[model samples]
Target: MGRIAAGDGESYARSISTSSNVEIRRRTRVTDIAQRVAKLMWQWAAHIVRRKDGRWGPKVLEWQPRTGKRSVGRPPKRWTDDIKRVAGIR
Candidate 1:
């Protein structure tokens, strides 16, 4: 048995290791998930546009809620805003 003391007046009991106490940490590779998501969003949008079925996906995407009063702060960002921005159109 061994006592591990810290500078904050805290002590902990640790067992003496008969085996190796080495810790191995491997580096994680970063992924471009944002790019992949954006690509997929564009593909889905294209598919929805090409659909002949009377689905509401395209309609909902273009739909806007009309109200008499407006909030004080900035308006919320819409999904189509991102798609339009990425498509290089205003």
Candidate 2:
């Protein structure tokens, strides 16, 4: 009778061990999939933002006078000498 009880206990222990291993493998696979999805989302968002922003094309500006003869308008989009000077670039 004692030997039979010991065999039952060993079988229960083995079952628990196998179940734990299966659970661990399932969790690892889920984590790997989530990481892959996150990386793809980041890349897609960056691409969309870049497309919305204007590319490296030339821009034309029209100058006009503001109140009290003050010359004010949207500056030229092209990088100019003044911009380089202020930027401390030679």
Which has the greatest TM-score?
1
Residue 44, model 1: lDDT of 95
lDDT by residue (1-90, candidate 1, tens digit) is 244457423322122223222321112334467867998999999998898688898897898867779777988788898888998988
* TM-score of candidate 2 to 2 decimals: 0.26
What TM-score would each prediction reach against the true structure?
A: 0.60, 0.26
What would the per-residue lDDT of candidate 2 be over residues 6-87, giving only the tens digit for each residue?
5589886776577764486685655566566756755654555456355532221122224465356964443244334644
Could you report the Cα RMSD, in angstroms, for every candidate shown? 10.4, 16.2
Q: What lDDT does the true structure give each of the candidates? A: 0.70, 0.52
